[model samples]
Every structure is written in C-alpha cells, then in structure tokens.
Target: TGTICTRTALLDSRATGMFMDLAFARENGLDVQLLTHPIFYNVDGTLNEMGSVCKEVEVILWIDDHSKQVVFSMIRLGKTKLIIGHTWLHHHNLEINWTTGKLTLTQCLSDC
Candidate 1:
C-alpha cells in the first residue's frame, strides 16, 4: 500500500511559486496536481514527507527532528537494539550510550 504525507512546514513560496508558473503545467497536463504536491517537486524524490499520517508506525524510519521526549521514553524502557534508518541532526542527540557497546547491531531493514 502506497501513501503520501505532506509536511506543511517545509513549503517554500518563492522557488515553488515560480515553478508553478511554468508552461509545463498545461503541456503535461499535470500542473494542478503538482501544485498540491510540492515536497516531491524540488529535492530528490527519495526524501518526501511520507510519515505524517501514520499513527502506529513501526521502525520509525527516523528523520531530521525526532522529538527528544520520545527518545527519552525509549531509553527509560531500556531498548537495547535500535536501528537507525537514516541519520540527521536529531539522530546524534538520542543520548544513548554507545561507547561501552551497550547496543547491538543487526542487518539493515532491506535484509530483514
């Protein structure tokens, strides 16, 4: 099942607004649809905001701003095995002790 979630915070009116005025809108018959889906338009398509609507997400597919409170909860419960799907600024702030090798590693999700 494929899904889409747009994070409204990242919207840029300048760059996107100019793109919307281009001729390809009517030529390709896609302007109206793309107008509403800006996050996928500018950057590499791989980084779209596809998690905003999920309620009970498994393996968070961690991104730029994981809340510190959620991470503290994970630490309080002693989750020893954490798979970081992607690294960003927030990933380094997770506060788990790794120098002592308290955590264990497993294969990446594609292999699992």
Candidate 2:
C-alpha cells in the first residue's frame, strides 16, 4: 500500500516467494492484504503450523535507474528484514555474481 524505505534485502534463490518481516511491514505503515487460502512451510521440509503466511504487501524496488513494484508475502523470520526470492529473480531475470557479490539485470521491463 505504501513505499518501503528499507534498503537491505537478502537475495535467496532457494526461496519460492518474496518475504517481508511482519513487524517491519507494520512499522513502515504498509497495508497487509489477507490471503483467503494461506500456505505454510519451512526450510527444513516440515510443516510450519504457526500460520507462516497469511498476508502480503506491495513495495517498490529501485534498481539502477529503473523502478519496479513487487509484492512480498509477510512472514515472521528472525534472520533478515526482507528477502527477495525466486519470484522476483525470475520475474526480472536477474543475475547474481556470487564472487563479486553483485546483481545484474538480464532483461529490462517496459518501464525500464
């Protein structure tokens, strides 16, 4: 619902969807859209019965000179504030240089 001001985001290729810390989303005054059918899971291949995902929020990502809007499902994770996962990587066709620790855009959207 509102712009996210956070700059730090972890790029996780193994993750299936973009995730945002629930507390962080609230502190930033972002609107949380409740999901009708919530899905839950953990990295350990175990069912996360604690209602892992029930809401989602939209935010804008500014990369280089281009700006793109993205949606992230809310989760209660302690490791990082935000996580850009497979959904974003595939949608934007981003390339990550592990050695240099840099991200490169492989394809440009119409807005870019």
Candidate 3:
C-alpha cells in the first residue's frame, strides 16, 4: 500500500513489535487491517492507555538502498508516527550510529 512514505521512526529496543500511529495512518490514508484479537500491552508490560490495537497496516519501509515490507500494529503513539521495534531490529541486526543518527544493515537474512 503506497499510502504514505516517512523517514522518521523510533527504533526502540524494548518494543515487542513494529507499530504505526493510528491517527497518522488514518491521516495518511494507509489501509488498516483489523485484527481478530486485540493487543493490550505496551513495551513496558503496562496496560495501553490508548486502548487495544485492533488494526494493522502493511507498508514498505525504505532505509537507504534497502527496502522491506513490514506489518505494523496500529496504535496511539504519543510522540512518534512509527516505531521499528525489537522484532525488526533482531531480524535485521542493524547497526545504529547514535552519535551520527545513521543506520546501516551489516548483514541480512535471505528472506528479508
């Protein structure tokens, strides 16, 4: 779904899954897929105040020369429009230069 393209995302080591802001997705015309079961936990295992995540959207994410299709749970994010969480980080084993704010894909699995 070429609904939206964004350059900014929060790379959080603690987040369990990738996520997209519900409002942002709607505002940008991203297609939302409803989940049969909703999620209620946050990165810290606390109750999600914004409510259950009952929808998701699949989008292609581009980072430099690499691009991958990702499914993101739609939720209400306080400060960010998207989050690239632990599941994605672990799979890609990405290198992040915090000082320079750059990301590099050191090694990639064939499937990705």
RMSD for each model, in Å, please? 17.8, 2.9, 1.8
Give the range where candidate 2 is weakest over 10 consecutive residues by summed lDDT. Answer: 1-10
Which run of 10 residues does model 1 get worst, by summed lDDT?
A: 69-78
lDDT of 3 by residue, 1-112 (tens): 5555665899998887898889888888888999999888765789998898999998888888888988999988977989988889999998889899999987978887
Rank all candidate structures by their TM-score, best first, as comma-separated numbers: 3, 2, 1
Candidate 1's C-alpha runs over 4 A off are 1-43, 47-53, 57-68, 71-82, 85-99, 103-112
Q: lDDT by residue for model 2 over 6-110, one digit each (tens)? A: 467888889877888898888888888998878776768789754568899877778666577778889887668888887677778876788987778868656
Please say which candidate is ahead in TM-score: 1 or 3: 3
Two-way lDDT contest, 2 vs 3, winner: 3
- By lDDT, who's the top model here? 3
Ranking by lDDT, best first? 3, 2, 1
How good is model 2 by TM-score? 0.77
State TM-scores per candidate: 0.16, 0.77, 0.88
* Candidate 1 local lDDT, 1-112, one digit each (tens): 1222222122122322111212322233321322222333224445423322111122222234332221100111122222232232223323333585332222123321
Count of backbone clashes for each model?
A: 0, 0, 0
| Model 2 residue 58 CA deviation in Å | 1.3
Q: Candidate 3: TM-score?
A: 0.88
